[model samples]
Target: MPYSNESHFHPATFILLGIPDLENIYSWLSVPFFIMYVMAVLGNGAMLLIIQTEQRLHTPMYYFLAMLAFTDLVLSSCIMPKLLSIFWFSSTVIYFEACLFQMFMIHTFTSVESGVLLAMAFDRYVAICNPLRYALVLTNPIILWMGIANVIRGVIIVIPCPGMASRLPYCVTNVIHHSYCDHMAVVKLACVDTTVNSVYGLTVVLLVIVFDVIFISVSYAMILRTVYNLPSKAARSKAINTCTAHICIILLFYTLGLFSFLTHRVGHSVAPYVHILLANYYLLVPPVMNPIVYGIKTKEIREKAFKVFYKKV
Candidate 1:
């Protein structure tokens, strides 16, 4: 953390180049971008309201789901408005400190979301694999502690990136190639070698994201194994059905994360526009989709949502 910025070129602001090749149609692109934002906000908002109202949903699984929904809200909100502003108004210049803050919030909530997903997977494992101890194990206090731990872990991992980024000599171009400010993209603007920055960022992705994915995968695998040995078809079907929403979300989240990461790091020949599109998709899609998936897959939530809407109507 000890560094000298005496020779570093500090800029007051950074220019965000919204999308590479699709600059001409930025106004048109904002339409779909706006729709995704609406979907994410309304969907996650509705999910939170539903979770809060339903006393039956005060259980562990629903608690984890609520946390996931909240995380989606924060995760998407961190970037969408700025992206929309860049697209619709060509307001692409962000203050340097604000850009770093955006980078922090986006990465922090993303890591927290991964942790939330891991917690959900654990919830599922306990419910299916050890039904007797589910209540005792994942008590309300324990769940609250898990949520705090997720946020703390994310903070610990990402707090350094922005600090390191701040010390870099950004004598290079201020133009960022993507829609929003991310650690790697911001680092790309730095004129310095940034080897330590790159190493730390890569280490975070590999150690934190990959570790969560592996742990969630193992949890699902064990849950599936337990389901396979169920005494009857009906029980097996029920168990699989219970996990269907979470499994779909896990696949979608990791699939998008992997592709985005690869496009940024490994896809040298890939189109620049594709990189921005994938990056936006990675942030936007899950929040928009998660509520719909949960509503469809969770009978209690589905029924409650319908009742709530029907009453409102």
Candidate 2:
């Protein structure tokens, strides 16, 4: 059987930003955004190189860390270039297909990041709670499967996105208020019924955010129990310290995410700009902060990165 034509419908314009009206705002925001983007790229790129070159970082934990860094690079790349263009060049018009592609990739990477975080949590849980079996449990085969599982989860969850986007009928307006083709922003422009799109989006959030958080929490709780049971004070401190960075990252990502979702949904037109700002932070913070957090917290990674750069110089 042939595939359906459900994916071919195109919208008129990809963006909704009123360029002339926001020239000053764009100019002001562009300076800081450009700096942030450059830092994110450099920081994440450096971490990726360090992970690849440093033999000490060849463990399962660092494998996931490298994956996370790669995801952050993609995530920031997906949004920042276009945003910088809008600010510097006054080019806010995105093609329909480009917008769809951007939305797909953004969601795909974000979902994969969530899955990767879950895998990391599981790794920490096993390492702390089942120390004797940590090596056996997180064997090469298991790490490979975990990577495959994340990719599968990302693709599967976003399967409905293209269909939902294609079905929407764009009538009058096509200007998206935000920097990128976010799910809610695009769906709001559809003249046709948007029930399907909203339902699918909510379903995805429930799975990725709700379900994933519950599992991560359970894993951490078990980890805490195991930490307390450790007979040696130094052992307990070391175990808790290892989890500190991951815990901080989880708290930041989820808190910002929940705030963005709630503010976007409840604030309406009164605070659209606020919502945009918050959403931008959600995308940018992880990429810029993850490398710094890991570098400062993980002594081996920090030392390896310094040594690699020192040798190069």
lDDT of 1 by residue, 1-313 (tens): 1222456676778889888889888889999989999999999999999889999988989888999999999988999899898887889988888998999999999999899999999999999999999989999999999999999999999999998898888775888887888898889877768889999999999988889988988998899999999999999999999889998998899899999999889999999899889998998999999999999989999999899889989
Q: What is the lDDT of residue 68 in candidate 1?
A: 93
Candidate 2 Cα errors over 4 Å, as ranges: 1-9, 18-22
Instruction: Tell me the TM-score of model 2.
Output: 0.93
Over 1-313, each residue of candidate 2 has an lDDT whose tens digit, in order, gives: 1213345334656764733245567878888888888889999999899889888788989999888999999999999998888888878888777888888888888888888889899989998888799889998888988898898888889867865786777665767777888887888887778888988998898889888899999999999898899999998999999999998888888888888888876767645667777888888898888998999999998898788779889
Name the candidate that leads on lDDT: 1
RMSD of 1: 2.6
RMSD (Cα, Å) of candidate 2? 3.6
